[model samples]
Target: MPATETSAASTPGAQPSNHITEDEASLYDRQIRLWGLDAQNRMRNSTVLVLSLRSLAHETIKNLVLAGIGRLIIMDGEKVTEEDLGGGFLFREEEGAVGTERTAAALPQIKSLNPLVEVTALPTLEPFVGGDETAMITFLKREKVDVVVACDLSYAQMEAIDAAAHAAHTKFYGAGTYGFYGYVFADLGTHHSFTYTPPGKGAVKEVIRYRSMVQAFDRTNWALTHEKTSEGGSPFGGYRRVLKARQYAPEVAVPVLALWEFEKKHGTLPAGREGQAKELAEITSELQTALGVHPKLLSSSADVVSHFVVHATDYFPPTLAIVGGLLAQDVLRSISRNGWPIVNLLVVDSLRGTATSSPWGVAPDPTPP
Candidate 1:
């Protein structure tokens, strides 16, 4: 079937007004006080396109719409199944809900979350399937999308959409959950923002230039080195050894890389099948060697890799909530330009109850002159 677009709003092409209404102001009163009126206005006038309508997307969509994003576009090609109802609150278990298209099944609930927010649904992700992103780029340009959030897609799919987003000059976020683990990656090209300072110092404007996901994944420099201090001596009277680390946790990072590699080679996750764990383990070892990661750091990650291989496709509501909440928060921060956004990659390990950020290929913020 051909691709089609649908909007929950009565007026499909209507753009959000420049100013927030009194009702909107009252509804978002606490958030406005927290981030100030300017940030609220920015969020109220921005449009975000979310790629899939899975569990993570369900959580993110709820947050964005409730927080008063001007418009939201949800694109998904799958149909809702009984399994989806487990983690997808957006999907109901009514008579016809199970077989309905994912986007169609969730549209009413999403719009019901906030009547002020305009919601659109694209019932297919065909445009983003192929290697070329020309169709995706054209769609983004036509819609004037401010940000693109891709949830629960493969690494290649996210990369393709990210390219389209880069071409259209839109901020990009790629997020997905693997059982108890999940990750989020952002590429806001040449992003500019303000950082809080002391009462007398005033806010500081900062600029961060981010690299593409392809570059971040293919980076080869994971080795550490020693350098002399600026004063020509270390505090201990010896040369200071500085480590140039790319990932926040090598144990988690290497396994995730291996998963992506496994998916790329086999065209699917391990899914707990026989010999799949062995294959993933081999891939993990290869990636660790290729990326120059220390064997000791990754030694304890064997169980992580095995668990990931078995449960890569499983979704837990609590895990989704945690990862999705962080992703949504960062999306809001990116839109409002209020706080520090995720530099590039954020990995969440529910087992350890930890969320770590890895700058990856992103460059440091410019030093003040």
Candidate 2:
């Protein structure tokens, strides 16, 4: 696709489908000045599908809807639990809401967030799961959704969704926050382009080719590869490349990876219990060792592993807000074709107030489909 500038006339009180109306222009005037009318128009025309209604999803939904996306579809089949009431601002003080469906209670608040955007609440995600993907493809086709965001799903479920999105040629994101830790993964597939403005420089055009989560995970390894000798045939020639590529804190990344493995094997998170923390620590140790982290590098990671063990299934609102904010912003960047999107994985450790992103085995194949 070629680049096109916004052609909405500067006339007063114009409301066209492909062009911004006077009221919209005024409402989003500041944002238009920041990202230009074209990007706003792109966002205005795109549809996004967000899975689940957790605290993180709530924050993401708030941002995306306020940004004035054309349509937002939220799907969560469960009822509102008491725990949900504490952190999720969308569910609060509604009559007979506790045992009823979550979507019914949330739709009103979500709609109230932005009347200009269309919000649809689905009762279930059954159509989007399992080996047969016809239902998922149909859902995407019927809605003309440009992006899919999966929140708080199992690794297998997320992998399946990513595959379906890839098959449909749609952008996909999977994000989850566990207590003070969180991560976001993206599979933009081929043909993703964006415009980025540097601090002082003007707009710079960019394109990104993302690998699927499955491929990235499969290629992630801790050991050195393609080791070459220095001038004197020293064996440490490739150590710098290997270590640099693995710079993200292994203590954090290893435990997150272990959490997925634990979920996959046991079909549920290891609840905080006697010996479970030890098991988690063992898993983290195994992963860290497998990834070739120096044993001495992990001397201080005991606290991180213990934190994950106890809080892997818990949700902290503050951390959720941070991850969700970043996730939603990236979604806007993707839809507007502006700024750099998260390449593959992003991890946050709010306990220490730190975050990092690494391109885990993303293959660079930018060929347009």
Using TM-score as the measure, the top candidate is: 1
Scored by lDDT, model 1 comes in at: 0.77
lDDT of 1 by residue, 60-134 (tens): 999999998888988888999888999878998964679999988998888788878878788887677653688
| 226-324 per-residue lDDT for model 2 (tens digits) | 232111111111352355434555557667888888888888887787887888788878876566566665675687667777887799988988899
In candidate 2, position 180 carries an lDDT of 86
| Number of the top lDDT candidate | 1
Q: Global lDDT of each model?
A: 0.77, 0.74
Give candidate 2's TM-score: 0.86
* Over 4 Å off, model 2: 1-16, 219-247, 363-369
Worst window of 10 by summed lDDT in candidate 2? 228-237
